[model samples]
Target: MESTQTVPINQKKTDKYPKSVPYIIGNEAAERFSFYGMRSILPTFLVAQFFNPSSNPAMQTMAEAQANEQTHFFVALAYAMPLVGGILADWFFGKYKVILYISLLYCIGHLTLAIYDHDLQGFTFGLVLIAIGAGCIKSCVSANVGDQFDESNQHLMSKVYGWFYFSINAGSVFATLMIPIIYAKYGSAWAFGVPGILMALATFIFWLGRRKYRKVPPSGIQRNNFLFISLYALANVGKKKKGESWLDVAKANFKEESVEGVKAVYRVLMVFAFIPIFWAMWDQNLSEWVLQAAKMDRTVFGIELLPEQVQTVNPMFLLSLIPVFTYIIYPFFDKLGLKTTPLRRIGTGLFLTACSFVIIALIQEQIDNGGSPTIWWQILAYFLLSAAEVLVSITGLEYAYTHSPKAMKSTMSAIWLLTVAVGNIFVSLVNSSIANKGFFAQLEGATYFWFFVGLMMAFLLVFMLVSGRIKERSFIVNEAEA
Candidate 1:
């Protein structure tokens, strides 16, 4: 109960960060540099460098469309694989071991790309490995951050996550800028090899922290696994003698802790239901947005810019805004008697995301109208999008970590990542539809951008309404302590 009490803004003392923080942060920065460095150049590489020159004009058009679709498919698959990784972490190898093993696989993936940059079959095989490796570690790394602290230092969780996100952007900022240049000037081998080298370094950095980390052992087999409980709940539906719901009956069969865990998960899932929509909008920065940039005059301040290089704007803003939000904006609101709760921040993020697409649509409209809008317009969109990312993505990490059951933290983290998977799948479908001249044929270009804006706006309204109804659960007590 004491843990549930809200500490006043000024009274909340900043906890000394864990010694392990630097190692984790260093590993994350390098890993993000590796991943985003490779990813930032993917769309252009697939569309331009991987084409079959012997194909007919119509086949060439189809091949380009296929390349775009395949890029989204790869992203979607990468995010989707976290489910497998999460299960492995929570139920088998635990977070640290799983991350270490998959990281090696990740390195191999990048190596394959460097070795076979010109071969489509080999390049794709490499992508598959990278996707699996990246997805596996995605949930564990964030959850591992939370594992580093307990009640004594819990207050600093938000700040640590801020730094965590800052490190991500820090890595991305450099990778997004430099990798594109490497890809354009020195070609794919150097681009891919550089990231692979970074990944190898990232793996080594993570190993350096092994002895220092506060590792949570796997829960092993449990009857209280979410899947088993859910099945039992369904099996026993309406079996209770009273007028109580099926869930209540199911709760009666579990220990008090297990019941509480299920309830917490339910609450988190309710919040997660709307998150995929936000992700759907957020992920476009890597794909559609880059495609749009390729058409614009990318010379800014006497420097020619690769289309992919524009992605640096996102991480640059993240670097600036995260500190502002952490030290200033959020704390200011806290002092003013306006608590910036995670859900509230997420809601604000959704609105900002919708607004970003509105900016994107306007920019697209100008492009459609044959007006060469300055690259600054796209920068404005990146600002809005990055702000939304800080609000939603960073806050969501905190929320998932704090709200999950002790044993299920990795599992919940995986669930959170699955929302990104869902979003990417949604984008893939949209891209497919537009490419195939199907249902979305009439909504190409600016209209496509406007359509997403409307969708996000609708999601924002629903998310706000739902958030108002769902009461937040108390933070989980550490199982070891309990």
Candidate 2:
């Protein structure tokens, strides 16, 4: 095994992929399977196995809505916890230790769900642990993928990231299809326990690669960390001299580089402010869309499909669409004199996302009009949604990474993930509110979907205006170029 000090920040670039790459990618595939598998059935499990036990239709409807709200809250917490995980890894333990230790807790979360299927208190506790565990490691794991490469293999990093994303979708597609069937055929215990076992396997696979990894050590408590810089800037903003912004005041006590980095993050965050709404609409494919499927004719070509199982369409489309866009669509567009820029992709995605919701709202109107439309309507909606995902999500992460300052690279990843938390929380708030009361009470039935459509279109305008004005800032470059 290499010492903590063995790996340097700059090393010779190699054309060959690192041997550890396989282990890391493999770990991600399995880990994604575990994570998505558990969540795929979670909303249904909550509504059916626990919350909706009462026979009254009113009670059942309330239970269903509450289950959906709880599901979003769970997602919100899971994404929100990345801050804690990032802080611990950066300031105390390295990524490897934090991931492993927290993953053990993650396994316990699944076990709790499997063992206490009907107990709300235990179930809630289990979810909290899982959310924390998932959030804590999400950023670290993604960062670890790049840590394995240097200049020699730098070109291969993009390809590796592509494969990394491929593995994620592959794992999700399989889990989404399988887990619900397991629950319906056998029971919740097997459904939940299967993913738990996979998580254990993922941990073991990660551990097995210990000797081959180029382990990046933690940077002990530093004044340059995002929190420290932000706090210092806020505390001293009033002392700013002429020709200075609020953050510039911190330059008295902090390095100019650190202040610049903090300011860059703030600038990037302005663009990010509109992104949570994307997640708010996109994540509904898991909760609201699934519930919608329950009211549809889920049979196609003589085969019956479970409502929970329908979400497999999104990832399934993702597997095919990502490659299609990279090799065919992108090249074709380039030849036509329109290079596929990240912001362009994001803007296009925002529009398509709103279009997809319009489809969903239309379908809901059909259902409300006492029509049992084919599952293909939702499947069609997933295609547009999945395409939007390939455009927005994949491009957005790369955008976040490239734009961050070197000092705040990992911190930016966590902040990007925090957007998803914000999105889910927004959904939870809207779902838990509106309903039979509140300002948006009129936003019932298909009107709910239409509201999100308006939200997406409004942000699309903001993003186009903002993204056009900002220049790309690459932290992965030389100081002068940066």
Candidate 3:
């Protein structure tokens, strides 16, 4: 049995890091730059850049749309597969081992894409491998941060998560700026190759932090956390009393440390149900959104911007806006006693997503009316969407970590990320159905996108209402400062 000391059996000693954090931040920045760089190029490459529309009459009608859908489907699959990877790491291989092996696979996946170049079969295989590898690393890296702290240094948890997210955005911003340039100049081979090299560097950095990392032994609890939680939730079904939320009953079953932890996990998971809808919309940037930009005149302020390059705008905004939101908006709200909890932030994010779609819908209306929509409209939408991402994605990460049992942290992180996978599936299914509908024929591109925008807005409203009822979990960060 665990004791009240709150220390795990195999916990390692770590310093309250002011400096070790920079290496993690730098590593994440480079890794994300590589991942996003390749991601930014995929849709355009698959669509007009690679596919031969003239040869396949059926494909010619909506080749770009289909290609975009495929991009989402594959990315979604990549995101989804990590659940398996996370499980394997937790139960068998251990996180460090999983991260190393999968990262190597990830590098290989990138290499396949670069080398296979013209071979469709080889390219698809490479993407799948890379996705799996990325999924594996994604599942563990954040949890690794948590491992670096213990009860004494737990105060630094917030700073660690902050830097973690900062690195992600930093990498994304660089990737956004550079990948498009690489694609436009050196083409796919070098663009994909660059990220491959960076993945290798990320692996090395993971080892560099090895001595400082907390090496908690596996729980040896044969029970699956999800199954256990599900049983507990089911037992209370239809047995409600006055003013008691399901979350309240769920929290009662957890041990003391996990009381707040369990509640946070449940709340995040519940909120997560609503997230896939937003992800469906957010992910369209590489797929449908970029395709839409293709039809627009790409000269912004007399500067030639590739349609793929425009995708970078969101990340750039994310990099700039995170600091603004963290320093300015979040504090401003906190000072006003508005209680900026994770649940509230996630709900607000859904609303912001709705507003983003509404803006996009307006832009589509302009195009339908024979008006040329300015690149500025898209930029405006990206700013709002990026803000929503900061609120949802970053908050969700911290929320997941705070809520999870120490032994199950990485698995829980994977569970939260799994929502993106669900959302991606929805994106692909919707796109495929719309394209297969055969309406508007030549105008299918415009028709399909507007359909998703409207649908996403409707879903967003539903999510906001559903999210409102989820009770906030009582919680505090437990890891130590160093």
Q: Where does the lowest 10-residue lDDT sum fall in candidate 1?
A: 57-66
Candidate 3 lDDT score at position 439: 39
Q: Write the per-residue lDDT of candidate 1 for residues 1-482, one digit (tens) a residue.
A: 45464555555544688788999999999999999999998877777767644545455444445566777778888998888887788779999999999999999999999999889999999999999999889878988999998656787888988899789978988999999999988989999999999999999999999999999999876777666767777888768667664556677777666656676787889888989998888888887788778878888999978899998888788878988999999999999999999998999998989888998899889988887777888898899999999999989878887887775565677788788888888877776776687786577668888999999888888887789898775464554366
Top candidate by TM-score: 2
lDDT of 3 by residue, 288-389 (tens): 677667656678898978777788788778878888988998899999999788878887887787677667777776766767777778878888999999
Clashes of each: 0, 4, 10
Evaluated against the true structure, the overall lDDT of model 1 is 0.84
List residue ranges in candidate 2 displaced over 4 A. 1-19, 149-160, 331-340, 434-438, 464-468, 471-482
| TM-scores for all predictions | 0.84, 0.90, 0.80
Which candidate, 1 or 3, would have the higher lDDT against the true structure?
1
| Error in Å for residue 82 of model 3 | 3.2
Q: Tens-digit lDDT track for model 2 on 233-332? A: 8888789888888898887788998888888888778767878998999999998899889889999789999998999988778888998999999899
Clashing pairs in 1: none
